[model samples]
Target: MAESRPNTEVDLNSWLPITASRKAKWWYSAFHCVTAMVGAGVLGLPLVLARLGWIPGIVAIAVAWLVTWYTVWLLIQLHESESGKRFDRFTELGQHAFGEYLGFWMVMPQQLIVQVGSDIVYMVTGGKSLQKSLALITPQADFRKTYYILMFAAIQLVLSQSPNFNSLKIVSLLAAVMSISYSFIATGASLWKGFGEHHVVHYGFRSTSTVKIVFDIFSSLGVLAFAFAGHSVALEIQATIPSSLGNPSKKPMAKGVTVAYLIVALCYFPVAISGFWAFGNLVEDDVLLSLEHPNWLISAANFMVFIHVIGSYQVFGMPIFDKIESTLVTKWHCTPGRPLRLVARSAYVVFTAFMAILLPFFGGLLGFFGGLAFASTSYIMPCAVWLKTQKPKPWSFHWILCWISMLIGITIMTLAPIGGAHEIIVSWKSYKLFQ
Candidate 1:
């Protein structure tokens, strides 16, 4: 007779342990995926739409959602194939697909870079919200940098000291609540004020050419693809749940991820569409800026933004620290005591602080991150791994579609220029002078 496989049952506790039921796992996966999608992506949509136009913007968002779903499917498939373990580390899947050495070198740095880039974006946005809030009390004070550092440090401390995954679940729940409340408040206020009536002027779409439309669609698609790229979190949760309760097959995890992404798209797309419709050409880089109106509404929005940012930092930071700890302790055989923990904490603080200082140079930062970092890791690398490792199933058409979407996403992101208003105005001036 074949030997029985070892049971992987874990004990549950309030302190640092990893026991979670199917219900807990579902909620955890849902919250993490939702939070990641909402962070910087929602805020950036209005500006993208204003430049690209309404039709292209809508198409981009829709296509991007499909791409995100497909990419996630590929990731989960890889996980299931290699380890036969649902919740293995992403790097392990890479290692199984590629060689161990190539996997370690490629996956580690890419994961770190993506996480760090995301944290920096959150820190900057959170700091901006705090600065705006403080300005209400001390109108002339400049606390942007100060608040950024403080928020970063606080997030680091919270993530580092958290006893277990349950705390993260609580944080995720709070984030969901804040996100729902903020979305409702912003939409309600916009409708009540007759937001469309105040639109000053409108600019016609710049390009009727097929090439221009394609380019616009591609650019917007990059943002949308990233908005739904956190399905790995769901995979992790699925791994922890009892296989007997649900199908041992990975279909539930994939289905859950699909539902979560659809929910996010529903919440985010309407807000994005409405913001662009109301503000037209005057839409700011951050849509939250466009939502600023009525003193009470502004305050409420600011507070919501602040909480959402904090929640984002906590969620992202925890996973990052967990990965770092695992690599150092298990892979490197380093003792993971107070000293190592402190070192990790200090590193996080310093990195976030530097990024906060560099936020004023947003164009350069976003360019480096979106073009080189995010595209390579989130879009290109995941697809490459899946294509190399997994056996094709009957429904493999979905996989082919995902790969194509990712290629389109990468091309679009690479071509989209970095600078915002200043760049646009300068380019227009140069063209006028030449004309």
Candidate 2:
């Protein structure tokens, strides 16, 4: 039988397959959200701090946290509304609040871009982390690009091929643990490198843009936004929370979200502040890359971070896989759990791997897409959706808050891309293609 098309206004609880197993509890829910929020993006927070100074960098991280937290709440609020019909997918919510045509156009493609783009980030980040770890024994294996290519193959071979997104609960939890472990390691190592070893110039509470880029402030700001964002998968992950324990009552999800981002702030701030203090204007795009030689602790930390990104890659990619698999099954009448689906997904992984190796300016491209693409889907759309779906009275406080969020989203959406684009251009000029 053909899979029934998703109905946004229908009782998603009755139909969505996610509710069947109830794979996630509150802590697991927090794990997935934290892993999603703090993946490859966190690698760049130190660099953001380097540009914005300690005070400003800390402020930016806080503001991003509050905004993202609220936006997530908005998404959750809108997801549960429409008189008890809940939505599990962002595209579904888009379809529900806005016209179906505009809604699909707004949500789906942005997700696809983010999904594919994030895989690229993982390949690069994971590859770099793997390379750093391996470099401990054999210091001469210095080609960064080679490691990225190797890690792509490694992930396909080692990581479990999940049957569906829900099955990735274990992966998400492990990924979260790995992330926390490494954050502490990285933070401690950075502070030590800065204070103990004296390997870098210190700039306490000062900001500087090391790279000459258009909209330099916005560019650095984009990196911070990317670091805190996980909204794309928020609803999908939330759907797995048992309905009885979720919104309209218990709001275990709300508790989970709060705890998750608190973990993020705790983990992120130390790394950002410590890293900038360590490297100052000399900080590289990835703080791990800035680690000086013969540091066993940092090397082990890198390995742990490397292992973590493997799971993070799957967490971000599975939703994309689900969407694509649905389309293939729906449009082409392809059966699920079959060779064709596997082949299609395998092909996508390869494509993303190549793209990551091709454009290795880790900070630039991701910042651009993160700010432009994710900023809206995560930030802009939630506010816009609430304003439209809730039908609030004109000029009310709620109305103003929604408008303010939209404005902030619009500014970020517009400026961050310019900064990201500039980063790409400058990086392209600096690095020889295929060198």
Candidate 3:
């Protein structure tokens, strides 16, 4: 019976989205991590810097990069923590640490929010980038953003039919390339504008009001936190790599993460520093938007951003697709087939697209969702699980590190939403939906 149990479980997971196959290589991890990490979030770093100023902004990005890297390493280690028992999903790892029921409740909600919220943000990103590109190409061609969002949703409705994570290799790779391409373009444009003969940049903070500055700082933490959100899907990504006693997934995963972080550092610092240097406190919420000149380059950069977010949408959406489909089959006894995927995934794309069209406050959405859920999954949950399961000695280095990371995560989770909500309300005062 014990041997039979293992076969049965393997058969079940064989049809699931995340665990359907395990043929991915180390380079798969590299680009997938890149596709996951460097999405719409990086474009907003300049705005975060605008709120934070030079010294604090640089420190904040550096600290966030280090913190998430450490916590993600912890998550990768926990994936196979139990000998011969792999926790393929974040929820499974949570179950190991906190027990089944508490783990499900603790991790599921936060994971869902991170996944679904990311899709929504990606929808907004794709649409806005598409809009920007089109507007630049044809200055007189005016169309409502609502139309562009639906067009983006239409593409997702088709691509969301991809069977599993392994099937998205090409898309993810292109996205990784696109991310690097646009980051360089934005950086180059910013550097040019900064050194242009008419440069008139101010290095002051975005606001002078102390109260507002505090809230903006809190909100900026969420923005910075959002950039490190690849941790939320770390376990799922590693689950794609084949594992055995002789060759563990962690070795390759760590290698890939190192490569991904180097790419992230290269993409992040140049854009943030260059954009802020170019526009100073006057930088737009998205650095790309601030680069108005060199119309052809900015337009191509926006198009690349559009393509990248398309892949990012799938990288984030695949897990949610797995959850929804697996739930219907396991609990409701619905038959799994093309019909199930077609309906469930199309419905999801439409839902996120609608929500994005309704709000479409890019920076505000990042801050709100970043604080509300991204902080928990990316920063807090991994460290908390490490402490719970590893049982490191009290006041030891690992113990103290987890505690400190959890505290910072808690701070971001509590305060960022208030700041984000304030920004949303301020935008709402004169804003019209679907405009």
Candidate 4:
């Protein structure tokens, strides 16, 4: 008998089939990846770069990029080995690669900590933007708490019922365009206004050394990593793409991941640099505030922030929802129907809303979440999985190097929040106003 050829058509109805074309896949993957990048870091980068200077900031970003790449590669390798698919839920990959028990525990903290934390950060940022925008119009109105509640409900409604992934592609594309457009506008406005003319000279590893600067830069590394923390989304994107691009190989998926990360870094770096250069020492928690432009630009950026939060909610919420549903159906024998999913998702929304209300100070929450929640998901868990699964294959020098870097990344993420913990506590006390 003649050898049979493999079927190239990716079944869209199947849960794990690669169904999108290469070009479409790349674009979609880039959208999610960049959205994750711009979520928290776009606002935080200016302060870090102002203190650390471009050199250290760039170095930290480079380290973050490396960590992101390795983490994605590990995920792809594990996914290929077990499910013959790309990673979607952390638990799915975990179960296949490790086993049920280990995967359950491994994914449990990630669902509670990283996923919920990301949602809280999104809601908090949205609340801050709402407050700022409202203050401009109805100066006397205290709408922060109301805005938070509304946003939480709105996001929950959208996420409770699953959305077409293609809609996400559109949202992601618009976000990327808005991010780039505002960045260019900000850069142009700063240049036209001569924002960098009165630049303050701050010494880093070169000039007069201060403990504060060193700590800030080190802490900023953690922040940067958190900013670049969604490489797994790239894997999901790849899984969504048609596997005919490399049906029997993982190279196409790897390429998609690499391209996605690079595009995100490109879009992010300019915004960070320009925002810092414009605001210098007086930079606010959100960099959009620093743009010296017409009211329209600021409004557009604010709206973009809202859209970005919606996208973030989807990316963060989906995996968490999937994990919760899986556990209920498989372990507890609860039916995973639409009603049950809604209930699970509603519970998450309520919980995240409570956190968002309790932690209204955007900057403090960003740092704390970056150090604790984002750190574990982006750095710690991936590293742990890589270490566990890639064993028996002798550890090469490169592997050792990656392990060392992972440790450093984890340490920075763990300890960086100490600098801001007191402020977060203080803000919690004052959060009642927002509540």
Candidate 5:
């Protein structure tokens, strides 16, 4: 199943985004994973937990962590599945697993959706967090979230032009730090609120109706699924690591991912449990929104969220940029240079910002996009490719595990989006665009 690469006078790999650099260390993958996984979605965990109650919510988060960790490892191994060839892109690996045409079609669409959808969500998260931070600082100063969204997009317009993954080192590093910082602040603040005498927290299901509760639980899974999303960029991240027969990229990649998952554990559990314990069913869709007291600290946390998502947007958007620019050069015969990068990247930023301005429903967007594509690319697609490529014995451990993971992912894929769409529709009834 090893597809031979064509001989070319010019090495196009140097021009492609993912393969442009090979000097990355194991730590790069660690923070990139953290920056990718612990994003705007973490802010929503309290709400997710609130919806599902204590036991189910905690169980859901734990299970998602284990499942995604396993699936991501499968993808990392599959990165160099073929001898002397590295599948830098998810579609490339998909092509290796299935065939050229079918794999491209299957993995590309889902991966694109995950990338573009994530950028859109980051736009909304960045803008809303900015707006909230400013509101806290200057309580009397009122402005539309659209304005902040534009402001946020302006920063991306510049950052998005970065030539390759290596260029994002500082941005990604800061984002990873901010993620940890705000998670700590959020968890500590929640504990503070929970212990305050004036506040009474009731731990119970947010919804009373069985039907509503069921849908909310499904939607909650999507939110949690959204929280654990870093799989889309796993191979691309690995591509940056220098690899050879004696020292495969997976060694360092696995080391990085292990540390990254530990970071995920630290950030996710405390924030989710403490926030839910602090606010119970009354938690806002974003935990930061729920913690309004101590204006300075909360404002700082929001600002940190703003800064963090700025990097998160690019992390997700880079692959999409690579896809678009590569296609333009290879298929359309466009020159690969600064002019192309400027035009392609700028258009993408504008597009995501425009969509974000139109639909800023953060929770609904997470659920919809998470289930619609995140679950596929982050959860299901890896396992699917594993089963196809490895062809494990029927009912054997690996085979059973892959099937079980797929079933869980399929359940999320099918149900979460329905709940998300429903949430969007509910929000849309009273919503207007660009206000």
Candidate 6:
């Protein structure tokens, strides 16, 4: 007779299951995703729209939302399908899904690049907003953008030292609401200028391209891809959702993601369309730059952009800080949330701000990070992990879909960065070091 064994109930679902004390409400999850995805993208949309024109740019936005949201769902699927092990961070998920080497080499580096790049963008953006705002009062002040970046860096260093993820929810929520506020303000400005002032609403239909049309299309698509980069923290946010000993359907996470993405798309397309209508071929890197002066709306929107980026920087920086704190505590015998950790994180923010001052090639870096990191972290790896974890049959519908998505990601990674690099090169000629 077979040996009798004790009965044990096992969980085949719910990776990163939330304990009762640690559980969060659904709105926090929604706000966190919104804060992660919306920054820097809105400011850069007019140029992206101009590059791809109205038709393709709008299509790219829609397609990117579909692809990004689908990959996020794949991650959710993978998390739900797992039984024993759990993933609470991006690198952890990558290490589990792929080999350890790929996680350390490819996934970790790309994510770090993306995160650091985000910090740089915030510095550049906040500096520009400060410069433009200060010009209103001190029109003769000759300080360079670097001073403004340093100024903003001081603010970010303070914000970055928030104790933990829970501490950032209100800031993240404010950042999300700030994005909505300024998106409407900027969109309204565009509409008012296009219809109210100019009385000429122009639309682009792929009429202008400095490079080859194909290159422009993919490059613009990269910008759209970058706009939806909340996937980096999807697992982190999901972990905050309230799960129980028995309840493990992932419904809260799913609902939160759906609401968050819907909110993103609603803010994204209207601004893109209205900005394109207002500026035509004259759209600047930031749509706000295209808005004429003597307008308080332009000033208000720019100030809002600066204020929002201040909070949003903390959202992106928290995950990086968590990683660093964990390493210091686990390996280096440093205390968490103590002086050493605070100094290290403050230095990290200053380093990113310094790099932005030195390079200030904001638009190009946006494209590059979009093509390189966003494609992989946001789509390819998630789909790959979903396939590996689920182990669907070869050539099955799910398998075919995953392959197509992976191919698309690879294509974006390969082609779009070239455009980004060329853009940086072109912009470099006009730039000087430290002012």
lDDT of 3 by residue, 1-435 (tens): 111212245665887789998999999999999999897889999988899989989998998998898999899888896575788899999998899999999999999998898899899899999999988889887899889999999999999999889999999999999999999999999999999998887888788899988888888988888898897788999999999977889999999999999999999999999999999998988889888788989999999999999999999999899899778777777677778788999999999999999999888888988999999998899999998888999999989988888998999999998888888888888789789
Write model 4 residue lDDT over 1-435, tens digit each, in one string.
222222322332232122223335555666666666666666677666765677777676677677767776766665555445555456656675578988867766654665677778787777666555555455586664657556655766765566334446666677666555655655565554444455563333321447555555545654665676674354455555555424623565566567667766665677667766666556665676665355555656666676666777776666566556555655675643556656777888777877777666666666666776566666666666777766635578646755765786578666767534644765677556555
Give the range of the ten consecutive residues with the poorest summed lDDT in model 6. 11-20
lDDT of 5 at 161: 87
lDDT of 1 by residue, 1-435 (tens): 222222222321111123233344555666766776675666667656766678877777776676666677667555565334553556666687788999877776766665676677677667666666556545677644555556655766656566334566777677766776676666565565444465564644434667655544444444554454464343444444445423553565566667667777766777677767666656665666666566567666766777786777666665566666555655675554556656875688567856565443332334344444555555666677776765456348756765686676567456643332233343345342211
Total clashes in model 1, counting residue pairs 3 or more apart in sequence or in different chains: 0
lDDT of each: 0.59, 0.74, 0.90, 0.61, 0.90, 0.74
Say which prediction, candidate 2 or candidate 6, comes out ahead on TM-score: 2
Clashing pairs in 6: none
Runs in model 5 lying further than 4 Å from the true structure: 1-10
* TM-score of every candidate: 0.79, 0.89, 0.97, 0.80, 0.97, 0.89
Off by over 4 Å in 2: 1-20, 157-160, 197-214, 244-250
Question: What TM-score would you give candidate 6 relative to the actual structure?
Answer: 0.89
lDDT of 6 by residue, 249-346 (tens): 36777787889999988889888888888887567777877775545666777777888888778877876776675565556755433475568788
Cα distance off (Å), candidate 2, residue 87: 0.8
RMSD value for candidate 5: 3.5
What lDDT does candidate 2 reach at residue 236?
Answer: 77
Compare candidates 4 and 5 on lDDT and give the better one. 5
Candidate 6 overall lDDT versus native: 0.74
Candidate 5 colliding pairs = none
TM-score of 2: 0.89
